[model samples]
Target: MKFSRFAILYVSFSLAVALLALGLQHFLETVPVLSPHFWLLFAVIFLLTGLAYGLSDIGIRKGGQVSILSLMGGLFLKLLISLVVIAVLIIKFPENKLLTAINFFSLYFLFTLFEVICLLRNLRDQNQT
Candidate 1:
């Protein structure tokens, strides 16, 4: 499926970024929490973003009347879900709230960037055809 290709690309990109961040952190001897948990969190975020984008693409391709509402709604839902998950994680680990929030925002921004780019590209293609 198209989502599978997108997922693979996103996963690779996310993983590479995470690795680079962790390596830099280690080399500079800064943060200590760039652990497996951080890696897994971003990986899941990437997957979720890709899945949402794929669904949006499918809807646009299938529904002749698809509108900007679809794009906005998808983004809203994804942001809501991500925020809720982050809230729960923060609540469960209050001691590391700052780090958790930073990591969450970083992942959120990265995924959002990818999501918006894909949506725009798809919209452009649709408009062309």
Candidate 2:
């Protein structure tokens, strides 16, 4: 029943991002035509997600019984995957500046996935080897 430091950090970052995004959402709503609270909220989420996942991946890859370089590579792959998802979404549902919302969510999901996959792969490699 011991908790991992990475897990604690991830949860803390997620909550902090949520709170910050909520505050920013309020601020965005107060603006004029540039008011895009939804997009702003998502932008914060994506940025935080990338930071948390990338750092976590780096730590695990470096000594989790797997190749550390792969962990570093996962960050780029995750970014690419996020961009592709955003592109596909934009093509499927054309929106104005609000498109940032989709991009944010896509990146968040992709980054989180990359972190998880890296950890799992490391575990698998360790067990197999």
Candidate 3:
């Protein structure tokens, strides 16, 4: 199935903001860490990442899957999107920028890991017909 225009817009907007976030991370080195720009850029990254996940969810809805795939796809796809965003940041300007990305990845990894385990635990494969 084809995606709606809003879905396309979400993908575009997320990529643009994610790209801008890499530049903003570099600029943060010279400005006050708590400056409006820092928080503003951070918020943009957060929103864009969320929109990317929303796009993923939309795609999943348009398709079909059962069992493991449905449970794993959401986590994996979001991680994939987040990783790409971070990778682009490092590739465009490689350095300790990886420091920030590393911390974020660790936190996200643990949280999503917890979520996936909890979701899987809720299902009983042996009893299902």
Identify the runs in model 3 with alpha carbons over 4 angstroms from their true place. Answer: 1-65, 124-129
lDDT of 3 at 116: 40
Task: Identify the candidate with maximal lDDT.
Answer: 1
TM-score of each: 0.81, 0.50, 0.43
Superposed model 1: Cα runs more than 4 Å off: 1-5, 33-37
Better of 1 and 2 by lDDT: 1
Q: Across residues 70-125, which tens digit of lDDT does each residue of candidate 2 receive?
A: 55565666566555755665566565546455436643664476456546755576
Question: By the TM-score metric, which is better: model 2 or model 3?
Answer: 2
Of 2 and 3, the candidate ranking higher by lDDT: 2
Candidate 3 lDDT score at position 24: 64
* Model 2 alpha-carbon drift over 4 Å, by segment: 1-3, 32-66, 97-129
Clashing pairs in 3: none
Q: Can you write out model 1's per-residue Cα lDDT over 65-115, one digit (the tens) per residue?
A: 565556766787788888887787777767767777777788889878877
Ranked by TM-score from best down, the candidates are 1, 2, 3
Candidate 3 residue lDDT tens string, 1-129 = 123544464456546645665676578877532322333334544554454444444444444555446545656666676667666666765655646565456445544544444343334322352
RMSD of 1: 2.6
How many clashes (backbone N, Cα, C below 3 Å) per candidate? 0, 0, 0
